[model samples]
Target: MKFWQSVEHAVTPAHGWAATTGAVVAPVFHYFYGTGRADILVVLLVCTALDWVTGIQAAKKQDKTYSSEYGLSRLPRTMFFLALPALANLLDRVMATPGFLFYGVTFGLIYHTWNSLTANAHRAGWPVPKAIVNLVETEIKAKTERAMKQKEGK
Candidate 1:
């Protein structure tokens, strides 16, 4: 339910705290602030537990059961996430500043996250574009319905 846990649930459904933090959060902080590697590790441990709970919710919603195999599959997802920070670091060193590295890596993560999400959605037999459109439509419907209900109540 925490911020990082939410991020993990969004990006890698089966990810845990240790892998997410160690691969994603710690590296980001280490590159950005140049301190608190230890803090990152500890926080990730807690977030991993939180990820499991959220993963369960996600699995139930999708009508699938949880398994250790699924959790372990997130290892590759963690590696993919980690690549951005590593590239950022290398670019920072070569470019003599963090600007390009930071933005480039940020965008890379965004793009990769979207691509992965779309792929997973497709694999789950939810047509990607239609699913996105449905989500948007659903949001609009909810908002409109809420407003109408409020008006009637008033």
Candidate 2:
């Protein structure tokens, strides 16, 4: 084959795969995040990356080896984080409460991740104020309890 034909042949399969993946993902993404809200996912991913990096640094500071196996464990955690907001979005739709559950769950997860990141930062030798840590802990606990009570009431 000629050079341009060879290049096209190589790229054609990749283009097909990209189109197929986009087709499968687009609707699900739109359903979960709604239109023009990809920034929510981007923020979640960025926060997750920061947490992972800080966790690795903390492990190093503590003279512990952060293995790839442990890093791989984060996949499930990240999936849970993503799935929770999707579920909340569904709940919001069911209740006809425009974006309330979705945004609440997403922001809650982000706040929790922020807490984890701050703790990791402290472990990695950056000092975080105790009051801020306490407040975060309290908020998380309150939210958890409220969720549990709501579940029980239902």
TM-score of each: 0.38, 0.69
Q: For all candidates, what are the clash counts?
A: 2, 0
For residue 81, model 2's alpha carbon misses the true position, in angstroms, by 1.5
Q: What is the lDDT of residue 121 in candidate 1?
A: 44
How much is 124 displaced in model 1, in angstroms? 13
Which segments of model 2 are wrong by more than 4 Å?
Answer: 1-11, 63-72, 126-154
Residue-level lDDT of model 2, residues 71-151, one tens digit each, is 797799888888988888888889999889889988998888888777676666767788865755654355345435644
Which window of 10 residues has the lowest lDDT sum in candidate 2?
139-148
Q: Among these predicted structures, which one has the highest TM-score?
A: 2
Model 2: lDDT to the true structure: 0.76
Among these predictions, the greatest lDDT belongs to 2
Worst 10 residues of 1 by lDDT: 36-45
Q: lDDT tens string, model 1, 69-112? A: 65688778765555555566667767888556655665565554
